[model samples]
Target chain A: MISQIAFVLVLAAAIYFIQKRFGRIRKNINLGKNRDFKDQVDKRLNNVLLVAFGQKKMFKRLIPAVLHLMIYVGFLVINLEVLEFMIDGFAGTHRIFAPFLGGFYTILMNVFEFLAIAVLVSCVFFLLRRNITKVPRFFNAEMKGWPRLDGNLILFTEIILMIAILTMNATDQLLQPISDHYPTTGELFFSSLLMPLFAGLNESTLIVIERFAWWFHIVGILGFTIYITYSKHLHIILAFPNTYFAKVEPKGHVNNMPVVTNEVKSMLGLVSAESSAPPTEPGRFGAKDINDLTWNNLLAAYTCTECGRCTSECPANITGKKLSPRKIMMDTRDRLEDVGNSLEKGGPGLNDGKSLLGDYITKEEINACTNCNACVEACPVLINPLEIITELRRYVAMEESGSPASWNSMYQNIETNFAPWKFSPSDRFNWAEEKK
Target chain B: MNIVTMAEFAAKGESPEILFWVGCAGSFDDRYKRVTRAFASILNSLDVKFAVLGTEETCTGDPARRAGNEFLFQMQAMNNIQVLNGYGIKKIVTACPHCFNTLKNEYPELGGNYEVIHHSTFLQQLIDSGRLKFEGGAYKGKKITYHDSCFLGRANDVYEAPRALLIALDADLIEMKRSRKTGLCCGAGGGQMFKEPENGKKDINVERTEEALETGASTIAVGCPFCMTMMSDGVKNKEREQDVKVKDIAELIAEAKGLS
Candidate 1:
């Protein structure tokens, strides 16, 4: 009875903290400008299924895809067993479903055991890839500190959690015959291999080990749930919504600024009858901080798992440029968190003086992007680093008139000559007269 | 070769079936001029009634928008839309993917809408309809590789049209390791052609050219004039200008049909 109350208290605490942190995150995301992604219901659902559920883009890198699939599938299926553990914790019953499920319970336990072993093996391989082999994507400049540690920590936790499950099952099998409280769950196929080691232990000692393993496994899971809210692993939950709201237009199409369009229409005397009134006060031209970006952009930043697939595939990054698309998303999330923290303390909020540009992301990094959409195409979750880059660039060009001199000259030539070059417009058809 | 203008078509109280949008590169760049003439020659031979926008045509503001000058972009877009709408243009074709993308995708929002087609797709249609035929072409069985223009391939999803045209030439179309949706940029997009690239280990064109050369194909086929200049400069940088040649798809098709 005492143990069950402790379990209830711990579970309630986990739920309370998870809710508080998630609420804070949602508030931070809402600080950005609103844009409607509610259109095209069918297409968005399809994207959620294919990109998020089906793991379609993950298959681009075949080896990692297969390994990740094992963990992803294993982890999800094992959580079903965790659900039973939760019920057993509340009711103080051992294998409560065993009586109702009867023979079917044995099959389910075997499948769960097989998946746990797969999870353990995959996690070990993942840890080696990150630490020993040191995959280039995992070791990029942005991945130096917490990002790297966070990755390895998640893998390590999964390995420990899997071992706890196997240990609990093995010890429980020995206690089933001696303790009336422990039900017969049949011999779990994978954990039975380890029963030989615990077979000679006294009944009291085996009961203690089983109970201890149960507590460790459930507590570890609760801790992981809270930790992910603060880690890059939040992608496991955000990927679905992020992929659902992904841009449905062609990859090359950059959205037109409606405010600029209005001003230009009035200037050219081309305004329609209804919109002919003077344009509203022109606000900031483009994104200088988190507030200027759309909510979807913020969602993307949080959804990014620092996979660096985008950076590895980026032409600018590959050619040793300062631009790393993965870094862009990471910086956005970091800055957003900073802003969120400041706001929570009743501070200056967005006006904390520092901004996304110049402070978090550099001018050289945004300039290096070719807008090739390679990063967009490469993203597994449909996050668009290119959109944020362009928005920042727009802020620099329009708000500050800080474009490079060569680009300013090109803009001038286009203004005067109706072309980027200084050549006359009358000469546009001269190529037709050239005798080839 | 005589090329008609939109003004001439309007003066005769008639309209051509298509308006050939001769972009800034096709108008000004010396190398790309030959591509313009080659496409024009093919159109003339096929007797497809087409009119050039000529001097009335202007930059589509693709560079301006990409460089983050939305004000300049909207201005250029509005001005061009006025002229295009004035002509009541129903269909348009261009050899430049950048111009095609802007005219097709961006212009519609500003009330400029038309059936915009890239020359690669335009030529493919001509071939598909049997309007253009080839006989024992110059590139017959020659291993030629096609570099995807980002604007054409990923921007608009027009990957198959260009490749289909190459196949019609009786040429062996070898693909680069990164082609179609995953194709690399030629270091000239997003207004990079107008300025130098940011500090990097190597230029993007040099990297892309190395991939093209790795295929061991003698000729590199391109659809965009920007890619043409970049790939040609890359081959020159590698000092393989004599051994390897960069030819636009239009020029290749023109040569295949004995039109140029």
Candidate 2:
């Protein structure tokens, strides 16, 4: 009776929270124009196959990826057995699961337990690798991003699931009498391995122990349920939607039609399309602050796992430029936190009064980006740091008259010589005339 | 003769089969003109009497506009549009991919639109129409690879046209590990051709040149003048200039089939 109730409570919580977050994600993706819908669908299917299933980008470092995938895949597989156990506990039936594959699920469950042991060994190796690499504190190297809260929540969730499996197995062995007609079947991989020592325990003693395991296992899963909703690890649900909505092509191609307008304008302050007054500078084409950016930009930052894969692939970061694409996403996420915290306390939004490119990031970061797609390409879940980076540069130059001195010099040369070099305009067709 | 975008030029009264605009690159750079002249020979051999805008061809102002110097770009584009209206010339073509992209895509925004074709695309079409035939001659058995220029490849999706031209000439096409749409920039897009590459691990063209050498191709084939110029400099800096050759697509085709 205790087990059945526990099953209903945990499963109910997981479903409810997952669906709630999924709704937020769906609303965010619908913000853009409908032109890219077919393209988005094609890319989404590709992302599910590549990023989610194949673990394509995760293999940049092999051993840890193997360890991580083991833990990941194990979590997926062992949970099936978990569901079966939960249903059996609630319904008062040992045969609640394993009916589908002609006794095949019984063998599959045992096989998976053996695999779970291997996954645990890989997790130990993963822990060692991170320690050696000094990438500790999974959220941020410093206290700049998602906070230690999210990592702890994820780690805690994993630990709960692991302990639940071990504790439930131990209790079952301790109270073999509860096994009764099923003989607490040595069919389980780990349980059978240790049953030799417990073969002589009394039925009553075994029954009491079974109760302890049943309680501990159910509570572990329920606690993790609540924490998942409020953490950066929410990508466990959002990553799918985020990847599905990722752009299939390059980001630099601007549409022939301009879409943004001055929202603050009233009356005849703004006439539409080639009016004699001439379109009052079109209110910041790139971005100045969080408000100027799209909702998907914020969503992209929120979905970041802080894997540092973005930083690794950034051309600017590699060349010792001040820009770390990982930090760009992390800073945006932090800005949301810092701003969100302030707003909760009735404070200002992100960037307050300063421009994002100049104050939050730097001119050094802006000029350093090669506008290469490396960071976007390397991102596992499709985060494009260059969009906001370039857009900010565009805003600073167009809106603020903040051209780089070198670029301006080249621009002047282009005006005079018809080429960027210091040649005379009279020489423009000299080579062709000489040829003819 | 006068220069304008393919769109505005098309409004002209002339019904010429082809209108050739020898871009400023063709006018100023020796190697660029060589490539253009070679391309011109191919077009003429196919019995096409193409008009050359000559001194009347004003700058497309792509560099100025992309560099955020909109005022200057407008001035140059308007001047060219006026000149083309005087030509009564409609059909248009360009050997320089940047000129081709500017005329076909950017000019529409400036109201100087017309039907524009890159020389490789025009030459390939002429070949497909069976209007031109190769004058067979001695060939070099060298490994050759093509570098896709940003304007030609990404901006306009013109990757296959140049490669198809090379294939017709029977040049060995060794694929770079990074080619097609994902091809790396030659550090020459967005008016960088007029400016130095002050960012990235190194100049992008130098990195691209390293990628080209990795292909072990004896010669690097180029469809865009900017890519050809940059890659040539890159090959020299890498100290493999003697081993790695850079040739324009037209030059390679002209030499291979002895069309020139």
Candidate 3:
């Protein structure tokens, strides 16, 4: 009875903390400007199914795809066993579904046990890939501090959690005959392999081990649930919404600014300028910071898992340029966090003086992007780092008039000559006029 | 061979079947001019009845828009749309993927809409409809590789049309390790063609050219004029200009048809 109450108290505390952290994230994401992703209901849902649920993009790399699949499938299936733990915690019953499920309970436990081992093995491989083997993607400049530690931390946590579940099952099978609370669902196939090691242990000692493992496994899961909100592992939840709201248009299309259109129309005499009323607050031309970006962009920043698939595939980064798409997403997230923290403290918020452009992301980084959409195509969760880069470029060009001199001249040539070069429009057909 | 203008078609109370959008590169770039002529020659031979926008044509503002000068982009877009809409143009084709992408996708939102097709797809369609036929296998069994233009490939999902044209040339179409959707940029897009690339270990075109050379193909087929210049420059950088020829798909098709 005491243990059951302790379990309920722990579960309540985990839920409260998880909800609070998630609420903070929701508020932070809402700070950005609004853009409608409400159109194309069917297509959005299809994206969620294929990109996020089916893991379609991950299959581009065969080896990592297979390894990730093992962990993904294992995490999903093993959680079914965790559901039973939740019920058993509340009811103070061992294997609560065992009586109703009868023989099926044994089959389910075996599958969960098999998956726990699979999860354990995959986690170990991932840890080695990050630490020992030092995959280039995992060792990029952005992955230096917390991002690197965060990657390894998740893997280690999964390994420990998997071991705890396996140990709990192995000891429970042994204690089934002696303790009434330990129901006999029949021998679990994977856990039975470990029966030889616990064979000579006393019944009381076996019971204590079984009880301790159960508490550890459940408590570890609750802790992980809370930790995920604060970690890059948040993608496990955000990937669904991120993929759903992904841009459905052709990758080549950059959205036109309607504000610029209106201003140009008035200048062209197509539409009369609004009577010079007392000047309203001036609107920002482009994203000077997170608040000027669309909510979709903010969602993308949070959804990024610091996966360097984008950086690895980036032509600019591949050629040793300062632009890393993964770093762009990370920097955006970090700056957003700073803004969010300031706002929570009732501070100046966006006017905190420092901005996303100069403080976090550098001018050189944004300029180096070719706007090739390689990063957009490479993202597993449909994060469009190119969009954010362009927005920052927009800020640089329009807001600051800070384009490189060569580009300014190119813009000038286009304005005067109707082309980037200083050729006459009459000479446009000269190539055709040339004699064969 | 005479090329007609859209103004001439409109003055004659007629509209050509399609308007050939001779982009800035197709008009000004010396090397790309040959590609422009090659495509025009094919259209003339096939009796496709196409008209060029000629002097009335202007930049599509792709560079302006990409460089973040939205004001300049809108001005250019609106001006071009007025001229295009004035003629009541129904269909358009261009050899430049950047122009094709802008006219097809970007122009529609600014009230300039037409059936825009890249030359690769345009040529492929001509072949598919039996309007285009090869006279001699000029590139027959010659190892050729197609370099995907970023705007054409991932930007607009045009991987097959260019490859299909190369296949029709009776050429052995070899692929680089990175091709199609995963294809690398030729260091020229987003106004990069107009300026130097930001500091980097090596130019993007050099990296892409190395991949093309790795394939050991004699001819590098391209769809975009920007890619043509970049790849040609890359080959020149490697001093393999004598052996490795970078030609537009239309130029290859024109050669195969004995039109150029």
Candidate 4:
């Protein structure tokens, strides 16, 4: 009875903590300006189904894709066992599904055990990939301390959880005859292999080992759930929604600001232009801070897996430019977190002197981008770092009035000559007469 | 080749079937000017009524807009829209991907809507319609590789049209290791052509040119004027200019049909 009450209180605390952390993240993302992503339901649904569920983009690299697919499927499928554990933990019952499932329970337990082993094997290989082989993407300059450590930490935690699960089953299988209510889960295929190690232990010792493993496994899962929110592993949850709201328009099409478009249309007499007073901040044309960006942009930052696929494929990065698309998304999230922390600590009216521009992301980085859309194309979950880069570039050009001299000259040429070149538009057709 | 201006066509109380958007490079750059002439010659031969904007034509402001000078882009787009609308221009085609992308995608939201087609697609359509027949000419059995312009391929999803035109030309169409959707940039996109690139291990065009050279192709076929300039420079750097030629798809089609 005491153990049941203790389990209930710990589970309640874990749930409360996870809810609080998730709520804070949601609130932080909500701080950005609103933009409608309500269009293209059918397309978005298909994208989510393929990208998040099917892991479509992850299959680009064959070896790692197969390895990852194993772990991903194992992680999802084993969580079903976790559900059974949760019910059994709260009810203080032993193998509650065994009586109801009959022989199927044996099959189900065997599958879960097999997955736990696969998860362990995959986790070890992943650690080897990151630590020993040291894939170049994992060693990108931005992945210095916390990012690298977080990856290893998650792998280690998963390995520990798998061990706990296996040990619990092994001890439970051994003690099934001695314990009064323990159901006979006829030979869990994988865990039964470990039965020899615990066969010599007595009933009390086996019961202690089994209960401790059960406690450790449940607690470890709860802790991992909370830890993921604070890690790049947040993609495990956000990938679905982020991909669902991904931009489905033609990849090359730059979205025009409707406010600016309407103003241009009115100026062109496409419609009766509403003449309005321009008293306030006229040069505030692009995103200078998190608040200036749309909510989807904020969501993208939070959803970034820091997989470095975008950076690896970025033409600017490949050509040794200052820009790394991964870094752009990271900086956005960091600056957003910084601002959110400041606001949380200091009331609603308090301001943080630092902004996403200049303080976090540099002008050099944004300028180096070729706008090739390679980063956008490379993102597995449809995160678009180019959108944020363009927005920041827009800020540099409009708000700060800081474009390169060459670009300014080109702008001037466009304004005056109606072309990027100095040639008169009258001479535009002169090329047609060329005999070459 | 005689090219009629929209103004001349209007004065004659007639509208051409298409407006040939002579982009800045097509209008001014020496090598690209030949591409423009070739396309115009083909259109003339086909009797596909087309008119140039001539003095009234302006930059579509792709570079300006891409470089983040939205104000300049809006001004340029508005001016060009005014001229295009006044002339009652509907169908438009350009030999440049930069202009094709902006005119088709960007201009519509800025109140400058027109049916814009890239020259490769337009030429492909002409060949399909039997208006321009592709014959085995100088490029017969010649190994040619097509370089996708960023604005044309990934930006606008125009991977097939250029290939279709190349295959129609009866040339041995070879593909670079990275072609179509996964094509590399010519290192001259997004206004990088106008400025020195940021310090890198190598230039993107040089890398792309290496890929093209690896294909063992004699001709580096291109669709965008920017790509033509970049790929030509890449070939020259490799000292293969005397061997491998960088020709636009329009130039190839015009030659295939013996238009001029």
TM-score of each: 0.98, 0.73, 0.98, 0.96
- DockQ preference between candidates 1 and 3, better one: 1
Each prediction's RMSD to truth: 1.3, 6.3, 1.6, 2.1
The CAPRI category of model 2 is: incorrect
Q: Which ten residues in a row have the lowest lDDT in candidate 4 chain A?
A: A273-282
Off by over 4 Å in 3: A272-282
Q: Candidate 3 DockQ category?
A: high
Model 3 TM-score relative to the real fold: 0.98
Consecutive 10-residue window with the lowest summed lDDT within model 1 chain B = B132-141
The number of the candidate with the highest lDDT is 1
**Local distance difference test, each candidate:** 0.92, 0.64, 0.89, 0.85
Kindly report the docking quality category of candidate 1: high
- Rank order (by TM-score, best first): 1, 3, 4, 2
Q: Which portions of model 4 show Cα errors greater than 4 Å?
A: A262-283, A347-350, B137-140
DockQ of 4: 0.68
Number of the predicted model whose DockQ against the real structure is largest = 1
Off by over 4 Å in 2: A1-186, A189-235, A248-252, A255-282, A306-320, A351-355, A372-374, A377-380, A410-432, B1-12, B16-31, B48-139, B150-168, B172-183, B199-201, B214-216
Ranking by lDDT: 1, 3, 4, 2
**What lDDT tens digits, residue by residue, belong to model 2 across residues A1-436?**
7656766776787678767655544443333223334645767788867887777777866866777788768866776766766667668776344444545755776777666676656655544545455563342333353454455446555754565465456546455445553334346667556566556778766555555555565565555545654566656555665676665553433222232222212232444554445456555555666556666666777778767766754434544446688777766665655555565467664537654565567766666555445577677777777666655655665567665776677667666665555667766545534533
As for candidate 1, its interface RMSD to one decimal place is 0.8
Task: Look at candidate 2 and tell me the lDDT of residue B36.
Answer: 76
True contacts kept of each: 0.80, 0.17, 0.80, 0.63
Interface RMSD, in order shown: 0.8, 5.5, 1.0, 1.4
